[model samples]
Structures are given as structure tokens and as C-alpha cells.
Target: MKLQQLLSHTRKAVDEYQMIQEGDHIAVGISGGKDSLTLLYALHGLKRFYPNHFELSAITVDLGYEQCDFTPIKELCREMEIPYHIVKTDIAQILFEERKEKNPCSLCAKMRKGALNQAVKEIGCNKIAYAHHKDDIIETMILSLFFEGRFYSFSPKTYLDRMDLTVIRPIMFVDEADVIGFKNKYNLPVVKSACPVDGYTKRQYAKDLLADLNRQYPGIKQRMFTAILNGNIPGWPERIPYIR
Candidate 1:
């Protein structure tokens, strides 16, 4: 598929969600993965002709792992002509040595996302976007269903009450394999997780389990993706009552 075509489809998503608007400044959470790079390039391509005016800034949170440097991503941002920021924290040690439970994906993601939110506010952004694609939506929805017995999925667009900023996922309609294809086509420089236990968490198990299910039932992934989009996704959680 043409990159321009892919970008056009993604732009429609950005428009529908009002992810960006006139004079909006957006901070993109980057992890040096294919999905994030795909988001950066899509915005880079769309910002020129998008009806609403907006800006893109790429931000990466470093877990302060040993010898982990993001200079390559910085340079790629330079070449793409987008401003980049790196927030370094001790996520590696925190995940590995301290508070390292058998199932730590939830906690690690929460802490990292909180830091990213704070950094975006500090940079004066009105909105922030993550690169979670359709597969992520499917996986997360399944995880919530199987483990928590809840039907919950992250919204494509969300508003934080306290900070009063919008959070969005522009790639929510795009698939993960498509993102990988785009990354390879662009020859993007990707950084791999250097952690000892990378991709070994409970979330990985969910991804693997989903893959197995798909093998057993072809086209199962599409059904899950549609379910997340069409079925009950528990947004507006702030309206719910607290129970003992």
C-alpha cells in the first residue's frame, strides 16, 4: 500500500477523534518501535495539509537502562524536522530489581504513562497521542475480559479531568502488521528494549495467547478488533459509582 494512502486513512481517524485542532500542540509518546515511528511519519505527512492547524513533538521516556542512549531517535527526529524530547527515569531498575512482581506490566505502564503525562504538561501540550494500534486494542480488551471480568478498552480520544488535556490514539484503526510494513518501507531506525525480561511479561502472554487463538480460528483477530470498536467499551468511567 502507498504510504500516502495509509496516511490519508489515518488522517481521517485524527479528524474523527478531533485528536488535533486549530493551534493545537500535540506531544507524541515514542518508544522507538515501529508503531511510534509510523505515527511520527503519518503526522509528518498529514500536518502539511490537515485542515486544522497543529504541531507534533516526539517525546521518549528512557528507563535509564545501562548504556541506553536515544541519540539515534533524536537524529531521526532531526531528519524528520520534528522536535524531540527524552525524559530519562530509572524504569529499568524499578522494573527489574525494585517492586518487580511476577506480573508487573500494569504497574510499569502506569508509572511510565504518568511520567509521560507530566512531561507533556511541562511542555505545554494540549493533547498527547500514543501509537497503540488495532492489535493493542484487541489484546487489551481480551485481557480485561479474561482476567478482570470487565469490558474495558482505552478510548481513541479521552480527556483528563485534572489536567484538562486530550489523549488520543491516531493509529487505533490501523493494524500492527501494517505498522511494521510502514516502518520497513520507511527504513526507520528502531531501538529494541534492552531489558533482560523484555516481552516476557503477562502482556506478552496475552499477545501469544491471542496468536494461538487466531491460528485455531482464522479471522478471529478481526472479530476481536471489531468487538472492541463496536461493542461495549467502558468509557466515561468517571461517571460510575464507587463500591466498597
Candidate 2:
């Protein structure tokens, strides 16, 4: 049932966002997490029958975060024969040791994303796919409201002006637990992380917020996920401002 749900969600996400196109050179951004690992596997499953003539090559960026491990990822990619590129940057040290950013995850994410964009472009790929799922979107929405004081969240599709790359979240319709289930069933090797020493990242807080909401309303997660994809919420903004 979980696998079926994952398949259905991926189908919806692809159709809704028009993420993958024929002749597209897609670069999957994998972090060795259940989300990304599941995404890679899902895409692989689709590759056998997808009508579109797109090519997939993954790029995993090593942020040099503590407890970071890429060995499992490399082995899995090898077994799957998915062309994978590993990019390394001392993002964790730069954010933690140098800037000492209050929220290292955000800073590290920004830096790693920039590096991913640059690398994908250098590889001559037009499309970059991320593993962000429904939960991440809801979390971002709540975070924006509570901290940034705005109605905001990552979009299903975004074309980066500076990077000249089309970014797509193919797992936008997938839930975190669904991804986990798929990962566990497939026995995907997930990279272990000890997290930042500073701790209490915005994502964690947002997750807590989501947990409470889930407790209050049993189906809140599914409803929120549907709302994001449908844009059914009243007065929801379409265009998100980009500083670039």
C-alpha cells in the first residue's frame, strides 16, 4: 500500500509540474536521505516506461558537515548504474566555524544549493531535480508565517534566472513517511548525520509545529499537502520573490 501511494504521488507530481520532458538532462540532487534516495529509486522505476526521452544523472554535494558519509551513496549508485557525480565543499565548516550562523542548516543549504546549480550547469544540464516532499513544503509555509512573516513556501517548479536552470521537485506530492516506507522496503542506505551542534534548526521547529498540527488534526498533513498542490487556500500567493 505504501509503495502504491508513492507511485501515485509521483505520477501526480510529474503531471502537475510537468517536471520531466523529453530530451531533458535531469540532475537529481541526492543527499543520501530517505527522501532523495526514494526519489532516485522512483525515477529509476519510471525510466523503464516513461514516454519522455529524458536522461538522468545525479549530483550529490558533500557539504563537509560532521558525520557526513558518501560511501553508501556511491555503492548504491554503482549498483543501480545511475551516473552520479559527487561535489565537495566545506559548507559546514564555513557556516559553523567561520560565520557561526544561528541556523547552520539554512546557511549550509543555501551554499550547497548554489554549488549544485553551478555544477549542474557546468555539466550542461538544463533541469535540476530535488527531493523536497510535501512535508517540507508545509514546514516551509509555517516557517515563513512564524519567522519570515509571509505566506511562502518552495514552489513546485522554479526557473533560476542567474543559474539558467529549471529546478523541479518531483516528490512534491510525496509525504515524508511515504518516502521513509519506500526507503525501508527497498533497503536503501541512508547517510547518518549527527546534526549541527548549535541545534534547534528552523526545520526542526517547523517539524515540531507540523507534529502538533498532525496531533490536533489527524489528517492535517494530507490536507495541507493537497492544499499546496491545488493552491486551494484562500489568498495564496503565486509568485515568490527571489533576491537574485
Candidate 3:
């Protein structure tokens, strides 16, 4: 997808969820992946004429992976004139070597979020923008249902009362396929994940299952997304009428 198209989807989600406020400063969480990079571009483009007048910054929690390089992402942020910060931590070591946990994703994510939240707070940001998209939303619902026996997914906007921070998913309306297209078209410098279990997680299983289900029953993804929007799930903001 082009920048304009990406911006449109992002703006739709932001406006629908009232994710941004006047004078709000949002820190985009950069994972050096296509989704996060596309989110960086989307919010940067939206900042151009968004009436609420919000500021943008970027943050990445470096998991201390030797193979992951962030120089290109830093340059991308510099080119966009957005302040970028990388929080270095030995999360990989703690999860894999020191802890030697069989299931490390949970702890790794917790540590990563802790690091990212601290960095965001130090930067004086009121909100954090995550790059979760439509496919993620659906896959999460599937995971919750199949694994946990619940029909639950993440909300587009969530307030972390304990941390005094609000997490917003601005690109929730954008599709993952579109994110890949945007990355390819824009030549986004995506740093491959060095984690050993990158693609061997339960989320990956849900993703593949959802793809298969969608192929068997066309438009199932859209229907499921609509259910999520209208499911009256706790924490989800009420849908605002589309203006255009």
C-alpha cells in the first residue's frame, strides 16, 4: 500500500477509537519489522494534517540480539524528523540463557514491554502506539477462543492504570498484507528477528489456521472482524460514524 492508503486506514482507526488527543505525545513502538515500520510511516504521515495536533516519537526495546541491526531504522526516524530512542536490555539472555525457560515468549514480552514503557515514560509520552493490525486482532481472538476458551481480543485503545499510560493501536484497520505491500513498495529497512522461536509460537499456529479457515470460507476474516467491532468487548471504544 502507498502512504496515502496507509494513512487513510490509520486515521480511520485513530478517529474511530479517539486514540489521539490535542497536545498528546505518542511514542511509536518500533520492532524493526514491517508492521511497526509501516506504523511509523502512517503516524508520521498522519501528523502532517491531523487536526488534533499530536506529536510523534519512536522507541525500540533492543533485546540484545547480536544479529539484529537498528541503524537503518534510526536513519528512517531521523529522515522523518521524529525522535527515536532504543532501550538496551539483556532480555534475550535473561529469557534464554539465565532463566532457561522452556516457554520464553511470555517473559520476553513482559521484559520488553517493561523496558519500552519505561523508555516511553522517560520520554514524557502520554500514549504508546503499537503496530498490531487487522490480522493480529483476528488471530488473537482465535487464539483466545481455541487456547483459552474465550471470545476475547485486544482493544484498539487500552489504558494501563498502574503505569498511567494509554496504549493505542492506530493501524488496527490496516491489513497485514497491506503492511507487507507498503514495506516492499517503500523499501522499509526491516531487520529480521533473531529470536530462535520467532515463527514457532502459538500465534503462528493461529495465523496459519486463520489463513486456512479464510481460504475455506471466504470473507470469514472480515466477518470475524465485524464481530469483534460489534462484540461489545470490554475496553473497546464505541465505533464512531464514518464521516467520509
Candidate whose TM-score is highest = 3
CA shift at 230, candidate 3, in angstroms? 0.6
User: Per-residue alpha-carbon lDDT of model 1 for 1-244, expressed as tens digits?
Assistant: 4588667667767765567779989998998878888888888888888878888899998877766667788998899888999998987787778876666666778889888999999998989989988888888888888889988888888999888888988887787778878877878788887767678876688889888999999999999887766675656222222121
Instruction: List where candidate 3 sits over 4 angstroms from the true fold.
Output: none
Evaluated at residue 241, the lDDT of candidate 3 is 62
Q: Tens-digit lDDT track for model 2 on 12-75? A: 6776557778899988888877888888877776677667878888898887775777888888
> Candidate 3 lDDT, tens digit per residue, 71-100?
999999899999999999999988888988
Q: TM-score of model 1 relative to the true fold?
A: 0.90
Q: Tell me the lDDT of model 1 at 175.
A: 77
Question: Which regions of candidate 2 deviate over 4 angstroms?
Answer: 1-4, 197-199, 232-244
Clash tally, candidates in order:
0, 0, 0
lDDT comparison, 1 vs 3, better candidate:
3
